[model samples]
Target: MEQLMEYLLHYVWQHRLYGLAPLATTDGQAVDVIDPGVHNLVNSGPDFFNAKVKINGMLWAGNVEVHERSSDWFRHHHDTDAAYNNVVLHIVSAADAEVRTADGKQLPQMVLSVPDYLQHNYQALIDEETYPPCYRIIPHVPPLTVHNWLSRLTVERLESKTDRVQQYLHRTGGDWERAFFITLARNFGFGTNAQAFEQWALTIDPQQIGKHRDDVFQVEAFFMGQAGLLDDTLVKAERRDSYYMRLKSEYAFLQHKFGLTPISHAQWRFGRLRPQNFPHVRLSQLARLYSERRADFSLLTETSSLDALRALFRIGVTNYWRTHYAFGEESRESDKTLQTSSLNLLLINTVSPLLFACGRQRMDEDLAERAFALLEQLPAERNYITRCWERAGIKAAHAADSQALIQLRQHYCDGKDCLRCQFGALYLKQGRS
Candidate 1:
């Protein structure tokens, strides 16, 4: 019973469902409910009522208590405050009292409940583990509504990403190109090495880094060294021949010349990961990309298609990286090339979103649309978050659903802001209205 009540409260609160219409008065009076505002006593207390509420053809006002039950109002003490005087309805789940407003007026209300099937369905979803029960069972759901919702949710998701991007942009002093490079490096670092990549960017000045454009290998070496991938303690070979050694020496030269700070010796985690995903290789790829496209984000801004994004992100490693994962590996490197899907993930998750955000800031809808299309073309990402939504009877046919699923997981489920969700109250009411 407690769990059910808690769920109901969460559902209502998350969805802002409290004070909704069809409220029942304490005396079981049947009336049409009107604009149910949040009940706050401070402002309304000075008057004859603690709150002002209305019912069908009646403008009710008084200090009366509302609750899941009439007994709870007394339990909570509405009689103490004149602020509750305007409560025209003694709304409750079960009515059993002769409650009155401070103005000495009796309030009317209505008992509201929803269908049983919807309730059971909602409960099953809230408690299930399966993904896409509706998609798997019901031949189809309405695509038009789903599509529209997806589009709306996807843009909302982008706005959130843009918010973070804007913060980074401000930190970078609105240098979109430098900001983008740092973003790309962070994304390339994947989940584990993001800190190291960011740290690497901080040590190297973006303007000076552009000078080594002719030799992509030297550029990659500098980035790799700055990522702490060229530590002499970790490498087995001497500093002149091995990849790590070469990078270390080059980095030392650059640091001396430009007075650049050394990247911290912090581990850019590679454990439990495929060698291809090692921070060294990622940094190399990033440096190669920057070296090849000195114009950086300006070039990316001009790009409009998935093909162009793929081309931009596909910058290959130098010959040395083609045969090595780390500095000492001489054996045939199996994971020599970056996967196209991985590139798409970086572009969609990192580049495209930032581009869209910048586009919106510049009032360039066309650029934003191009970024949107790139994201849409990619296959939806499957994760625990999406699985939960699917279990909840929500189906995704595209990236919009994926975006909503992420937001749902981040801001709603994980944050426990169920009452703040659009589907929460209705979903709860459907179960036990």
Candidate 2:
């Protein structure tokens, strides 16, 4: 078993899972646990602190130390460290050795007794091969319990994303617009090219792009060139394409003027991607957005309704892209517009998180709540993880539910952090009862 099983011991102790039987110390002295004490400590001294217990009809209050085996107390060399001097109880899964303090005084030890079925159930979860170790038991949990957990997990996901936005804001010297642009650019990748897009965004100054936003062609040239899509060699080889030639020439002038370096096109991926999701198409759509709404980009955080937010992203690529997914390539005529699914992704991953971060930095609760409200109005995402939850009989009702499930799967279930998960904890508790 992994060392994480030690947390299960902590859970058993915290919830007093020793059953209705009388408790006692290792030396056969009757014992009673009055208060499990505070488990939250910033700097660790012991596993638990300020515990109050009655031993042999005498009350004793001190710290409680836990381990898988009593010998770990000495194995960890707690005898030499003054930190373990005030330990009133040494709770372990097995008491294989006598524990003594630094002053050579015998400390009370107890072997924590847990129900056999609980341990068996936890071990079964650990050995389970499913993505969520407790998938089989998820439906057994009360709906209210699952809803409460999902709500908390969704906020946790939002807070984590908001933290990233805050880091970017700090890196950009508190420039909210630039941070938003970088985040939006990354999201445009839609998971396939997010990293390359982020690197490309970092290379071009948003102010430089904003300077030429009045001309959609100039914005397109700058964005495409910075993304390394308008390389001189590639453009020269496709000289027969007038639109490619124009962008190449404009990018050359802009590159020299701004002394801007472009990210390598080798970083972009094209395999297994839909034609509409090609990097060239995504960049064009992003270029159109900035070209039309450079000055009002920050106003997106204040958008209250889902329709208003959706309206802001209702933009299509320039006419040049209507017949092409990339330079020097001709396909059937089609309007390269941001689809509803793509728009929903942007609102969930980029817009809402940015809004939440902005609200937190400004201490505006209304804006933060508005950001969460927008998530409620959006539809649930359809992806492999959501489908896994669906197969397990957990259907996500909205974006918040789906987002929370994504978080739960990635952070808790995948890592086998059952002790920290509500579902896992409930499963263990139910098995014990």
Best by TM-score: 2
Off by over 4 Å in 2: 2-4, 22-65, 71-90, 96-109, 130-132, 232-240, 294-297, 431-433
TM-score, cand. 2: 0.87
What TM-score should be assigned to candidate 1? Answer: 0.71
lDDT of 1: 0.63
Which candidate number would show the highest lDDT if scored against the true structure? 2
Worst 10 residues of 2 by lDDT: 231-240
Clash count, predicted structure 2 = 0
Model 2, 70-130: lDDT tens per residue?
Answer: 8888888998779989889998888899989897879999888667877887787888998
RMSD in Å for model 2: 3.3
Residue pair clashes in candidate 2: none
lDDT (0 to 1) per candidate: 0.63, 0.84
